[model samples]
Target: MTPSAVANLAGASPLPAFAPRPRSRPNSASPGPFGPAPRRLAVAAPPRAFFSSAPYQPPEPEGYSSVREYGLVPMVVETTSRGERAYDIFSRLLKERIVCIHGPIADETASLVVAQLLFLESENPLKPISLYINSPGGVVTAGLAIYDTMQYIRCPVNTICIGQAASMGSLLLAAGARGERRALPNARVMIHQPSGGAQGQATDIAIQAKEILKLRDRLNKIYAKHTGQNIDKIEQCMERDLFMDPEEAREWGLIDEVIENRPASLMPEGLSAVDPPHHGGGAGANGRGRDRDMEEPSAV
Candidate 1:
């Protein structure tokens, strides 16, 4: 029952005393005790792809093209105004003897045309010329200049009337070559005396009148050259304001023949025989004719 008696009976010994364990140093290749050091990766990642661009291009040169192998050079001269003179250059290129004069003859425009033709002649001599006229003429001086250029062209010239050639237009038609040609059916040619305004002192007026007379002489001379008619006969015809159809013009020797079927005559220069210049009677009616007798009320 007592504690000593119970222990004696059980015969158990007290707990054994503890002991310390032995220790050793780590190897040289091993990492420190705290933790292993971080390792670096020698990776070769796939190559990257980026966008690239190309350079720009420029335009083509004159008379040339990347798409075309050959191109034609056209010499075009439009006689619309005096200051704007391109037709003169075209005329100068006409080494060909045949030429046609069509449409209204503005002062500056006519000068440019004559100058161009003369320029052509200066480069190369040509025989007589061909003149195709279709117009309601303009300035007297311009018309006269055209006449002179035609007369001195030094070759046999021909004129063909396709439409209405009225007023100073008639003078130009008459200046055609001896054996002039014309279109049949609708062709009409008219001849009337020179007309203009009288603005100046008495002396100036007198001078202007003298100029008119001189122009008349020049016109008569043109008629004489082409028709073999005297100045009186031509003057008489002009005085009454003659209008001739193709047949009448032929009978009067104004034209030699009528060309109805042909691809227009073309000279060495690129000019081709074509229809007469057309003027419209729209808002800008520049070619409308006036009755001279109506203005001469005092004489009547």
Candidate 2:
């Protein structure tokens, strides 16, 4: 009825009241005649089937195994390890003044090559830079980008052909410092006219065609200048894909000689022919490189 009574009723919950817990009395009968009952001994619990785990196993040295997990982290670690090892070798190579161009020439490859060449020249203009080539050749402009840099640098670039130097690759071999182009025994070289596949409107195609002709002529001149061949003869030879072995390449001026024994020059002390002082590396130099001689790292 009053305000306090109304507030108390409003605050109360509508749940039923709980019953208080009942109490139990102790046994009235005491330990009479025997004083107390005999007690039983406690028994222990049996052990569970918790078998021990198998012994630790190491990862495979080489590839992988189906029994084990091969996750992204392991794969990434492997790749990074390989890359680091390769880079160590490359740094060793740069220190030794050796470079390589061993893939299809392209803008990316050419850019790296140019940078290496320039850097090498700056490192020591007197020390020669070796440009090893094993490519099938690619973009004419890209190839020229390297060739132009080779000429621009003050250092002499000694180019060595390992597997093959086809088309622009062959031209680069010839473009090396006079008397420095050399190929491994059994290595092959190829030469051909500049090739193009222009696709566009008729007028644009015509203009591209003209430019290709100009490139061809310019390349012919470059070959002539480097190989000491007559422009007419070079042009005639370039009419088709002309592949030549080391000996033939040498005779044709694509290379100066075919190497059999390891080069004695630049061979550091205690650097055996069997295990040459070498490590893998990446690109740099005045971009001093074989035109993208941006070729991947050859096995050291």
Candidate 3:
């Protein structure tokens, strides 16, 4: 029977048939059937090649190489590698006829002084060279080298003692300036016999002792020549360290004059003036006060 006739007979209306929904195909821009699409993270790839293709190597060391396959290595390495500025400054000072001996007297120091004195003598024999000394003293042989050179050189060397001149240093100062040695009012002076050591067999030690005696006698004669003191008296005084103030040094004929003023030419540029030694104070730069306790009769 027709649904419309049946409905009319039943006095009821037929309901409209429902349509089915269409299924969607999976796509790149669309979500999956399960839900929303999962996110994908980007990753970077490692490089296959380096900028340098050569095998790794270390840089070569510069200047001197202390390493050696065998033999003894030096405990100390002497180098003259100074900055250009220092070289320039020293060069200028050399031209000014002013040289400084501000440290211990030693072979190296004597060499430098000898070189400068020789140069000055060759350049101008009459040119006056001023040597400023402030040392506690050192090797006797080294000081003697400088002393003999000062007398041998034709150039007039004016030694000004700005601080303490001890042991062989005193001899050098007294011998300089051709008996015209000058000392600062606060300077100190000391003289003592040269001390030495011998390490060997019995005969070798005896020989060294004889040599030391001869050296001491020679030094005594030199000191006597510069100062009017009798050789015997000077020898006796040198047996024990003889300490003297500036005034006492002048009276002893170790120095000619005690100057109160420091000449501009004598002072080095860029250096501050040193304060005078205190009368009853602590040690000064030249070790004026400490000599009584600390002074030793070593090589100087």
Candidate 4:
């Protein structure tokens, strides 16, 4: 039987069907099902306000400022992905003619450091660019890419070795602007022949071996030229991993000063000197990984 017919038979009248009423325009101050809707707050000059634990205020039409800049009148400016920190000391150093390479080198990182070098050159060619390095090593081609760009730029790259510059890192430390290459008293430097592993067929392995030899010869010459040593001497020195303390590095023409005399000039401004990269590599952009195997046949 139909529901309506049954209902009429059982009772006096059929039950009315539910029909929802169309809601008209909501009131500006109506208490909603979830309590009163929060009014859009307008932050004034001095009276600071907090609503929920989320967005500081509605994004302004002009721009947005980061929470990092809460010291002064918050200028709401949109943030960017250029670098992680808004007011990190490293970010500040980048602005002040300082570029740091504190880990293993790679194409993307080398590209960024190269771009920073170029941009700083465009800003002021005569000013010196400080390059703080604390790295183990990385792909030969990547390091060379940065090395070539450093030479191409007009501004001098004043390299400073903080902890250790090894393999390709040591090459960069030596290639910095002459006389300005300096290292902390206890910093270490190392240079060794490029090492790599080859996969694939026997013929391919042979080809890779030949290329490694050529790379070794070329690297020897580069070291000799920069260190003022003969090619033979450099080749012999690099046959095994040659380690050097700052003093010994100076004697080997790797760095100009051991930084023993200058206590006050350790940092440029009042900012404290940055700590060097720790022993085991971390997730920092530059210290990600060691890709020495890919350095076998470095690209031109």
Candidate 5:
């Protein structure tokens, strides 16, 4: 063959053949609309309850069905629940021939004092009993109950004022003692006419007002008799609350003497001075202490 024909034949090697790349398969376990079949996962089943189980049950009631069924037990619990310390102190004082009227004068308190006084009087009629008063005063009737009992008892009652004696407390201080009423040097005393509110018809309210006036007159007479003050002057002074220091109280005949130095025997073993006034209803009615503005009339 000629040289040109040989060159053409050499250059005429066939063009290399092209092949398409293979596509990758989708993962069977992956989540997709057009994915391959899913692979099963090995998961353990929950344990059966046949061996041990408890059925669902409703809760029990939280409160009692009838309070009356428990009777006075609940009342006793309630009274002592908050006043355990006071009750303990009171019991100790009673054993020591002492009666502490440390809060407001109230019906329940009067009853308690009266009962204790009677018991003590029965035990030893001639023994000298100490009546410790530190109050802002309360219901006049309740105070009068204690006052009358104090007077009726055969034992000699020595009233001692510590922090304060005001309104009904003043009455108790004056009438609860036999001869001389005493006060701490820093004690305060107050005297005022009985006060209260009446809710009723107009006529009934007027009647209640008249009754209160009459009760006030009786109280004035009692104060006058005890303090040697003229009833008229007492009435005048009592028209508004009159506060006095210990000396002034003594001068006014509210207290016979001011205790300059308290005897060790006068206080409890652990106490230094008088106990601070407890805030809640102590051993008194409504579980509350005295309120100066709300002092009620004796006859109410």
Candidate 6:
């Protein structure tokens, strides 16, 4: 019988049953080591595919000479492949007068990248930088690190999303400078509650569950701080796995404006005339993953 028909015949509610005393996690507002800092947060995704692409050898700009000659440095993180990593790109890009960070960001790698960027910027007082983001979204901690870094940087920071920036990625975009500088398109921007899986012995599994709850609470605080929405409202939408398009994100104060595309002139100017792929052994843009298997990333 149809679900509606059965409901009518039995005069019973058709909604799915909720388990009694359902296990719950703490909210992100709790004060603890796991709770996020209050400076404003943004987010990003992981590169689960690019890792396998042919080893990359970053190009060297010929006669790149003075930093002034090239207005900005291009730091592209296009692939989100597992074990490939984001730090590899961030560290190198930070050296440029103008740095652009983009690509599929993910996992613990994203956290490391943002941390390194912040560390570098903190040490270098003269660095002026901007960020370019295009991602689907991945690890929450990594996203948080990127967001925090943006707030701490002394130089002006701008964020522009080209294609789609969903999930944690959208959060990072929202964390950009307030007012006219922060812009995204009418493209879709998604937000949802954080989640993860655990597997272990029953006792260990129980312990893992507790940790997961703590993580959930921390994520709740991130939403509350950035969106200025009550935790309850955030959780309500999260419970249902909500996604927002560009228009909704802007209305919610998640983005500044909807733009079509970045001016071509905004492109990085400091590439080496004969620049090799940023990495030493990567095939770089070519469909060859062989070198990547044998490659180890260099210190940027």
Candidate 2 lDDT score at position 51: 10
- Supply the TM-score for candidate 1: 0.52
Tens digit of per-residue lDDT, candidate 4, span 112-223 = 7899999999999988888989988777877888999999999988999999999889999999988889998889999888876555667766777787788888888888
User: For model 3, where is the 10-residue window of minimal lDDT?
Assistant: 47-56
Q: How does candidate 4 score on lDDT?
A: 0.73
- Candidate 2: misplaced stretches above 4 Å? 1-86, 266-300
Q: Could you tell me which residue pairs clash in candidate 5? A: 281-287, 281-288
216: Cα error in model 6, Å:
2.1
Q: Between 1 and 6, whose TM-score is larger? A: 1
What does candidate 3's lDDT look like per residue over 27-109, in tens digits? Answer: 65577787777767886443221111112123335652322212442232223345222233334457667777766666667
lDDT per residue, candidate 1, 1-300, as tens digits? 999999886886576556766666555456877665556678645332111000111223666432232243344443444543343322433434445455566555576568756765665556445556667666666677777876676544556666777767766776665555555558887776665445546666677667667777776787777777788888888775778887887788766666554333422333333333334222212232221111111210
lDDT (tens digit, per residue) of candidate 6 on 1-300: 899997787976668677799767755565669566455476534212111111222334676332333356444343345654444344445544344434444443465556555665676754545566666666565666677777777755666665666666777777766653344555576676666554545666667667657767776677677667788977777664566767777777677766553332233444322334345644323233222211343432
For all candidates, what are the clash counts? 8, 29, 0, 5, 2, 39
- Candidate closest to the true structure, highest TM-score: 2
The TM-score, computed over Cα atoms with residue i paired to residue i, of candidate 6 is: 0.50
Better of 2 and 3 by TM-score: 2
Error of 6 at 227 (Å): 2.0
Question: Candidates' TM-scores?
Answer: 0.52, 0.61, 0.59, 0.60, 0.59, 0.50
lDDT of 6: 0.56
Q: Rate the local accuracy (lDDT) of all candidates.
A: 0.57, 0.70, 0.70, 0.73, 0.70, 0.56
Scored by lDDT, the top model is 4
Candidate 3, residue 44: how far the Cα is off, in Å: 75
Show model 4 residue runs off by greater than 4 Å: 1-85, 261-300
Instruction: Name the better of 1 and 3 by TM-score.
Output: 3
